[model samples]
Target chain A: MLILQKISQNKTLAATINQIHYVVIIGEGLVGGALRDYLINTFNYKFFYNVKTPWTDKTLIEAHFNELKTFIFEKIFNSQKTELAAPSFLQLSFVWSAGKAGFAASFTDIDEEEKDFHSFLNLLTQIDQERPAFVKMDLHFTSSAGGLFEGQSSVQEDSQPHPLRPYGILKLRQEQKITEWSQNKSYFHGVIYRLSTVYGRIRRGQRMGLISIMLQNGLHKKITPITGDLYTLRDYVHSMDIARMITSGMISSHKPHKSPSNNLQVLFGLSQKPTSIFEIKAIIEFHLKHKIYIQFNHTPGNARDITFGKIQPPFEVQARDIRSGIKDVLTDWYGAHT
Target chain B: MEGTLSVSTITPVYCGAQYLEELIKQLERVRQEWQSKNYPIQIVESIFVVDAAKDDSLAILKTISNNKAYPWIKVIELSKNFGQHPATMCGVLYSTGDWLITLDEDLQHHPREFIELFKAFAASSYDVVYAKPKDSVHQSLFRDWGSRGYKKLIAKITKNPFVIDFNSFRLIRGSIARAAASVCGHETYFDVAICWFTNKITTQKLSLEDQRYINTGTSSYNLFSLLSHARRLIVSSQTKILRLGAWIGIASILLSVALGLHFLYLKIYDPEAIPVRGWTSLYLTLLFMGGLTSTLLSIIIEYLSSISLQNQGKPLFFMVDRSSDALIQKFLNHEPIDH
Candidate 1:
């Protein structure tokens, strides 16, 4: 009987200890960071990697999984982890667990066309060698689902994921790769969730999106250029919604089946209703109470990602409408920044 | 109308005893269905290549062959214990047919899918028919990702756009099978090399019957076995130097040097505009790079497995312990294995 262990990049592994284990996650990008926060806040889990105080609020944000920092680097990165002395301090905060890993390795700006998707798969392979775990979900991009399965059109029962960008196309190929891998039965469960643009309050100078960039422009009264038609639809869900869906599905006794297969389920993350970029701008403008000049130039952005028909989960939240979500963002922003 | 086929196939008696019986039963159903469909499945031959099984599986296989009466059947027991792939090759080497289907002893690949593969092969102009899994036979995300990574890497090596199949099931023409086996000499992976060897490939997507893992019972490929498999396809493939060099140059040293030169020039010319006036950020940067370099170095080092294999001139597999060269002769004396 050979005992196996998965030494995850998260410094902390996502799975409960298994007798034989393997875990695979890649990039440790924005969504991945939020996943770590979900694990820390929801489970009150501690690890040996980083220097940061534990998170208490049920808020979600993203960060990379640091293998070297363990529980040691959390404090180093989170100088405020000890200074913020109360539970009421939950306006908006995050403790990044930095490590000897490449948190500061810089590279020249890459051409948008120069990215290699195959290398991304290879990097995933490298990560798996450190800790081998069956990936439950492949959080990436996609395109059409070829045709209907069991009856419903893909966009109706499944995520009708037709991604328009090269990045998303790479992600689509990845999803295909994951599905095929799951088929090979290398001890892997295949789950993929195509997420909407994740949004929430953030400490400026991070990300290039409507929420962060718009918030910055609104604060500075800088004119923000609108990409594409102002009404381009985006299924922007709360970062918490992203966190909630993943944790619940993974830990839940009954793993949600996209179909009865229990092998592959690809889903889309959205509110009960779809929201457009223009609608988001209106909400932010109304709540922030500051109307920065809107330079409307309709050149288009993000290959116009295809939409999906809403599949309501039984545990759906009445869910903050666009207006409410904007308020939540503004309130969290003011409280955190101030 | 037999839309599906059931046939009892066996991986034979050897160490695969753990997996043989279940494989036979799965194929038995497929074989039965093929007959019921009135399908023109050239003469069906039940094949068993008994390499020293070291367990009851071989005996069980013997018991099975003794008890059963069906189409033309033959068991080729080697003189000693040869591994599964070599034994399989030995079985295929002598197969008398225009097409040959090979599968693992593990129950991950259901033999019932032969009809689907056969039908797809019939419908297409392509010589190779690949049965793609709609999902996985195992439940781990890491292994799935790693397997995918391996496929991509091998694809890169061969410069052949690989149409990955559910490696557990595939059907190829007799000529292609022999050709692939010849080119793969002593390499652990036969499936991937086949992909490298072929240009025309088609895929048929199918789903696993839910209890895939429990059905396989336990995998014979332990952690070491899995890694070795990865090494064989990626690191030990016929072309590693050019691929490895291109990869390292593109990924690591070149980028590192460019960054280093840029930072050095920045520090030497304009000390006033140094991004880091203090040493804290510098220390953090150093720690980060130190770790990154070490990790990448280790990755590059792992690609050296082919060197060891070539140096010893050690063959990858050896045929062993066979009791029935005469039985194989006798079976052939009657008719071909495929007959």
Candidate 2:
């Protein structure tokens, strides 16, 4: 109670008000952990995530609702603290993570829609419950690419979700949903980043980032049995740069100012420069200083080469080159937990 | 085209016991036609989803259960009747095939069209082949008008100029069908969902003869029910009201001014039309305005329902573990390995 009062009155605290937002990432994957770090130390926001689960456990159904309720009442409402007073700077700028997005989609595997959809709902359950007043960002990543290459660029903010696969389609539908969820809610503002392909994190799981997989295998001097094709390039950006850009967005809420019709800002977060698989392989090979075997089935068409430079919102940091990024990730990989 | 694609024929039977005989007759004929001609597609399975049928549908299925004559037939009896769409969704939930097709059990939509749907699907890159009713013999003028009007109205509202021939009789790529089926909600326009899930949709024209035996079969829908379905479709499939509201809002402004001027002209230029009874005009004005206000309120509620559905953390569909083998394996791989 005393801490809340003292913090509210503290000008120094208010000055860095852009640093006070918080979030709970339920999926403890690379993106989830990165979002947590950005919100805590980098952005310095406070948050509470109720649970983390592997997949479709019956427990998540309850955990989702429970944490969402707590966020709505105890955390979000309590965070506001004053009436009509402009939130301190830290509370603004941006609050987002380009977490669950798929690059390519196909007609097979409709069940993925069910699984990916739950994550969206879990997040929404949190969004609806917390209805945060101070924070202005409800940034999410939906499958924007599926609807793009499926004949035309029908992936507008209002276009129907033409998901080739269940994952991309569900994610695309989630874009419409979050837009609808944030509308007239009066609590928090929203912005969505249509991230291309994020690299740099050295996550070790079955669903590890593709770049990490290749780099990891190269570091270990093994052959990476790559899926899809070699020419399949994506707008891969380093995680730290992505985080820095997100922090910058949370700090400055200008450019595409908030609106009722468009509180949901959509940005295709490429590195302002794209990286292809061949380049990525070369970079990894150079960085590791080893002869990494090259294996190409074919270059997949999942990588989108569309334009996204119009709403190029400013960021504070630069994304690393795939070559340099491979070295950094390798160093971090061995540095942590090794 | 090898045309060897197997078909999963699904029929969502509500209180449609009367239509069962004709529906089965059509299916039997279709089975014979495809088998005899060696049609490119083979009958993978036949699913009769009888939801809450008070009639002897369970008894009917029992009569056929032991009969080895029908190569592949699956009867799923729901504990209770879950309504038309839900019942249909239940069948979709149970179906397993490369191509999923549905038709009205009332026999209004013939089984002869199945071959056409299959042929088109096999010969093209289209993910979903949308069937349009080329002719309707059994529909009354009122029903036809209602159907056409609803189509146009929903199209205007959704802003997706859909072909008018949309019905239960259609063939969808198995993947698209499952994708649309996965997000199955209690209430959804299944056809619109198909469009939302696919890029290539081919439209085929067909003719329907009159369905005479609809009397004994119970119709759970009235005009009010029709309106409700239309309401649900308009709400879920499209976000037309904000634009509609803008148009109506402008119209209201224009109408209010025009009415105001007319009233002024009447009061100033000619006092005779007023009837010298102040209560009449006052009551008339109040009545008109009251009705208009109610219409506006209902529109607002419909918009709010869409917003709530969209915003609320609701899944498009839920999967039951009754019969999904592939899904089980996929789910396993996604989970953490014990090692």
Q: Mind giving the per-residue lDDT tens digits that candidate 1 earns over B1-339?
A: 112111223243455666676777766677667567555453255567787767666677667766645323456667887566667666654343445676666555567676566666654345577777777646666656776777776667645455245254567654445444443445546665455445457877766432434455445556776666666665334554354544544455455656667766777897666656657345546645665665565455544545443331223321111122232233324444322
Off by over 4 Å in 1: A1-338, B1-29, B79-81, B140-146, B149-166, B209-212, B215-217, B235-339
Per-model TM values vs. the true structure: 0.35, 0.41
Taking the candidates in order, what DockQ does each have?
Answer: 0.00, 0.01
A1-338 per-residue lDDT for model 1 (tens digits): 00012233353443432211211222233444555555567555343233232122112111222332222124322433354432121111111111111211223211221133333334334433433122222223222222111112113543344543334444455567767654644333334555555566554554534665676688778887765444344455665565565544443312343342335556655553434454455456555655546676645343132233334541343334555666776776778778
lDDT of 2: 0.55
Candidate 2 at residue A24, lDDT? 35
The residue-by-residue lDDT of candidate 2 on B31-95, one tens digit each, is 77877865545555667888777777666764674466653566767777776666665565445
The alpha-carbon lDDT assigned to residue B333 of candidate 2 equals: 38
| Interface RMSD of candidate number 2 | 20.0
For model 2, residues A1-338, the per-residue Cα lDDT tens digits are 00011123456654544334444344444554565565567444444434444344544655555555554456445555554354543232223232333444343443444454555556555655555434444443423442343322212333333445455665566677777766656555555565546666677664567789887787777788765544333456666666665555544443334443435556545554334454465456546655466565543344322222112433435565555666778888879857
Error of 2 at A309 (Å): 6.5
lDDT of each: 0.47, 0.55
